[model samples]
Structure formats: C-alpha cells, structure tokens
Target chain A: MQPYNYPSKYLENAVEEFAKLPGIGRRTALRLVLHLLNKPKEEVEQFSATLNEMVQNIHFCSICHNISDNDICSICSSTSRDKTTICVVETIKDVMSIENTMQYKGLYHVLGGVINPMEGVGPADLNIESLVNRLKSNDINEVIMALSATTEGDTTNFYIYKKIKDYNIVVTTLARGVAFGNELEYTDEITLGRALLNRVKFNNSFSVE
Target chain B: MQPYNYPSKYLENAVEEFAKLPGIGRRTALRLVLHLLNKPKEEVEQFSATLNEMVQNIHFCSICHNISDNDICSICSSTSRDKTTICVVETIKDVMSIENTMQYKGLYHVLGGVINPMEGVGPADLNIESLVNRLKSNDINEVIMALSATTEGDTTNFYIYKKIKDYNIVVTTLARGVAFGNELEYTDEITLGRALLNRVKFNNSFSVE
Candidate 1:
C-alpha cells in the first residue's frame, strides 16, 4: 500500500513517532496524531510532557528492579507486606497483574525479562544477580516463580531455581491448572492433567449452603 | 475493574497520557508506556521531541486550509496542479487518500470536519467560508465533494451545495457503488442500486480482448 503522505512535515514526524509504539500501525498512528491535533494546546503539551517527565524521572526499584519514582519502590518499603516471600516476575506488568489480584500480599522481584536465547537474553542479562543477593542477605523463606508459561519464562525460572537452590529458601512455581471460570474440556492437556492430579476435596463450608 | 496501580507516579502519568489517545484503552496505554521504558533514553527523547516539535511548528494552508509545514501547502504552491478544480474533503486524511491514488491533479480544500449536529459541529466550525471565498476569487470550474457516506457527510455536502449553488461552479460528489473487487451479492442495497442507475456503456476498446 502507498503510505499516506501527510500534508505537513510536522504531522508526518508526529505520525512516525506514534507508529514506533507497539501494536500501532502507520494508519492508526496517523489517526492518533490527527486526534492530538484536534486537542487543545495545553492537553497536547501535557501529553508530551507526561512522557518526557516519565522517561527522564522514572527509575527501576534498586531492590526488586520494578519501575519506581524513587530508588526504592512502594511495595519494597511497605512493612506490612510478606517480606519472607518474594514473587519473581518477568516485568513490572506482571507485578501489577499480581498486585491487582489483591490475593498475593508478598513483595516482588522483577526480572526485567525472561531468558530467551533467540533474543540473545540470558541469565546475566536479567536482574537475577540482585535477586540472588536479596535471598542471601534477607531473611526470606520462599521464592515464587510467577513467570509466563512460555519456554523463555520456563528457562528463566529454571536458571533462578538453580542459582537459589543452595539457599535455605523454598522455591516454587505458580500452579498450572484450569483457571477460574474456565471449562475443563477446553483447558490445555497439561493444565487439565495437573488440575486433576492436584484436585482438592470439595469443601461443603465454602459452598453456598 | 480497579486500575492497575503502576509502582511509579511517572509511569502512571505516562500511561494516563497514552490512554487519552482516541482508541487506546488503559491496558494498551500501559503496554506502550512500558515499551518506551525499555527503549534507550535518547530514543525516548526523540519520540517525545518529535511530537512536541510537530505540535509547535505545524500550520494550516492559508488558501486551502490543509495542514502545512509552511504558510502554503506543497499542493497549493505547485504550478502543475489543476487550480481550476478543488476537492473538498472532511479531513486531511481524505486529502492524503486522494493524493495517493495519483488520479486527480486538483488542489484540495480540507473542511477539517463535517457538520454533525449531534456532536455540536456545524458549518461555522468548518472552513466553508474560505472555500466559498476561493470559488469567488479563483477561476475554479468544478468542486468535488469527497466527504464520507455517513449522514453527517451528506448533511455537510447539502449545506455546502446550498452555499455555492449560485456561484456558477459545477459541484459533484464521489461516485457511490460496489467496490471494484466486491461481489454483487455482498454489495449493500443503496450502493448497488446507485451503480445500476448510473451504469456506463460497455466499451470494447477500454476492455481487455
């Protein structure tokens, strides 16, 4: 397809910048940039300034490698969280997902990325060393591997498990089973099999009696 | 759903700004903002700066009201373009679409937007006055209404038609029919009917033998 030539060089530049965003194509970029043009001057300024300030000021948590406004993240600083348990995740996004669940009260250690050999990412490339150091230094009891189900996530989890195996802490992976509201028939074979093997006794008290 | 509380305030701000975009949801915005965090500092600077510079420097063409880096757009300044004809479009996107076809040699008059009463947009909101002024001053013979097929587009077309009916200029709209590759069975009723009503004579000379 012939690239839609923007009437203005400025519009073209804006569209190009927008297209750099993940999942945004050139046409969608154009549409977005045009929408910005229709917005008030202050609104557009705020939009650009927000990004600029974020890029300039944002820093990774010194302890867990999660993004933070300060050197130490809010979760790391909070005394109420389960300091003994550290949920290891691939990125800050996973940390947010777990936090939103409101089920896990433990602290987090963001790996920044999983070990993907195809992408030239290895154990050394991640924040694994700091995690190992945290386990050695802190009075931690458990380390939960909350990575994705992909090969890269598995590889990263295995690498971390090997590194921290010598420590006195218990290392565990997130359970592989049929998710809540998911039908057993549609569940993947491995997940369904795991769910069946680890089946819990039906509790009458927990049911709507 | 509870908004994913980003660890960093800066990250939150960036995500908020991204979510302000036309079709972007909060989750997608977070993904994009997080992607920017992974990019190099200089690359992020370029992305923001590109938008900032574009917003600050962009202007509208004095004659046609199309977006321009300069006072006069490239099409308006070009000696080769047919000045006698002007294609009236609802937005700069339409102008780009037509220009990409490379079939029309006419200049364009971007309306910025069509009349939509429900959206509180009317003739006063558009660049209709300047278009009428152009018809009066310039030796333009024909005006092509390249607006969309929506009710708003039709409203805008009729409104403009009434405005320029007495100006001794030929006014026309884009052809309505089934698209070139579309099957007749799948074609919408109005388009198929219009195509039939405006049927052209078959010419063997123009066809492949």
Candidate 2:
C-alpha cells in the first residue's frame, strides 16, 4: 500500500515532525500525533515545553564533555568520585551506562565518538586534546578505556594509548569476556579465549560476602 | 545496572515525557532528547509549535468523525466519492490505510474503537450513533466493516449488524484469509478454512491482461 496522504495539513505537519525522531516511522509518528490529539491541552503543552526547554538550555560538561545543565556535570563536580582515575568513553550514553553499573566511581572523559575512518571521524575530531591537557595539568594515575567491543573502539584506544603513554600514567582497557549469565557454549571463541587468558580469581569475582 | 540519574531537571523531565509515548523506552527517550539538544533552536521550536498548533486547532469531521482541520474533512465533503457506500472503520488510521490502497472511492464512518469489554469500551463509547444517524439521513446502500481481525472487531460488527439489520442496508465484513506472499502450509486453520469456504471465481481473482 502507498502512504496515506493526511487530509489535514495540521495533522500532516505534526506527523512529519514526529517522524524526524530516530527509529520512529511515519505510521508510528501518525499514531503518536493522534495520541497527542486525544490528550488534554495542558499535558500536550507540558510535553512540548519540556522538550523545548531541554534543547534550549542543556549544555555539555566542560571537564568531561558529558551532557549537563551547567559548565560541569554532577559526576565531574562530585567530591566522592575518584578524580585521579578517569574512565575514557565514547559518548554521554556510555557514561550513563557505566554510572548505571555503579562499578566505576571514577571521573569520565567523553570522546563524543570513536575514530572511524569510514565516517571521517579521527583523533583530531575527538576530545583527545582536552584529555591530554587534563593529563598534563592534573595528577591522574590511571586512564581506563571503557569503549565498545569493536574495531573503532580498539583504534581509538590505541590512538589514545600512544598519546598518553609518555605521560607515565597507567592505561588499561575493560576486561573482554563472556557476559554474566551467558552460556559458555554460545559465547564466541575470541571472548572465551580472552576470558580464559585473563581469568580473575574466584574470590575476587563476587562482592556478596 | 541501575539507571543514571540525569543532572538537569529539564533534561530528566523531557526524557520522562518522551518515554510516555507508546513503545518508547527510557534509553530511546534519552536518545531522542539528546538528538533534540543537538538540533538548531529554530527546528526544535518548530517541532513543538507544530504539535501545539495541531492539538489546539485540529477538529474532527462532524459527519464521519475523521480527524480534520475543520468541521468537515476533505473526504466527507468531496463530491466525487460514492456517499451511498460507507466503509465503517475502527479509527482514522483505518481510513488512511484504505485510502492508501486507492481501491475504494466510497465515504467512511469512523467508529473510533471496537466494542472492547475488557477495556470498558462499549457501543455507547464509540461514534456508532452518528453512523446510524448518517445512514438514516443519507441514501446509503452499503456499509462495509473494515475492522481489525480480532474478537473485538467481530463483536463490534455483530453489534452493529443487529442495530441496522432491519434498515434495508447491505452490511458486509472484510474478507479473511491468508495474506499475499504467505505460504499455504503456514496459514492458520480458521483463515485457511474461511479462504477455502468463501473461494472466489477464478476469473475475478486475476487482474493480469
């Protein structure tokens, strides 16, 4: 079937706007617009107002390059976090993911994106300079690379490794292995090999006690 | 992993609002909010303004209950459409789907929803009365039920059938069978039985010259 041409220009415009969002198709956009039409005027107003306020006021953390309402993000400014150990990640989402784990209490350095030659993203395009500057000025002891398990992530890690190797800071990568609760038979060979090679002590694997 | 608590109230509020939409998770909502943050101020303004304008000003067609910018929708007002044949659908989305097919040139009667007892929706809750009124006022000869293939749809069709049976109107339901490109072996029993029982003339099935 061909696409339905909406009769009302207002409905069409609303659907078009909704469709601009990531992963939202025209059919889904129409459903969302119609749902808004059924809601109270005040609620619709609140939804739009909240989005507008976010877009207009939201800023990035000056220190970590993470999303924030001010110059410095809460994580960056927090006194409890281990500022000497900075976990370098690709995007703000990565920062949120690591924060969710509650396993990493260190500060973050968002690179915005990984170095992908195909996408024209290079070390120069990332926040590498700021990271180097942070290393040069601050008393950082460790730099943990918590990037994705991909070629781009590896490339970015290597690039950053070469840059900070001369600064006398310990550089490390996230441990590669089968995820918790994953079946050993279903796990890929590379991950299984790595997990075996860098096997942690059984007592150190759990904090339940 | 626990969720990362957003620093900005505005950002959190926006993400929460986006998450309110059907099928959108908190992660997807955050992505959408971040995408808006990256967009230019004017584009975001336009997105909100369009939704606001639609919710504030959009109206439904008085005759058919279809979404419209005015009292009468284009389909309802169109002189070329066969007003005598009214296609009864559950929602505006159905109308759009039928229109997209470009096979039916008849008018439409939007019932808004089926008689879903589980959800507390009944005949009184839908726009059924208006449809009956339209039949009474107009020279409508046929009323085609274009509802979803569900028990609720069947219940609604039966209910409406009882209401207008004595009015000398020809009431019909959509054909049920295996869909195009579907393998006969995989077709369900009820649909396959219906297809076999209501087999059409061989000559009428093909449009190939």
In candidate 1, what are the lDDT values of residues B32-109, reduced to their tens digit?
Answer: 988999999888888878888888898889998888999999999999999999999988888899999878999999
lDDT of 1 at A20: 84
How far residue B191's Cα lies from its native spot in candidate 1, in Å, is 1.3
Listed for each candidate, the true contacts retained, as a fraction, are: 0.87, 0.74
Clashing residue pairs in candidate 2 are none
Which whole-number lDDT from 0 to 100 does residue B76 have in model 2?
Answer: 88
TM (chain A), candidate 2: 0.95
For each candidate, what is the lDDT? 0.89, 0.89
Give the TM-scores of the predictions, in the order they appear: 0.95, 0.93
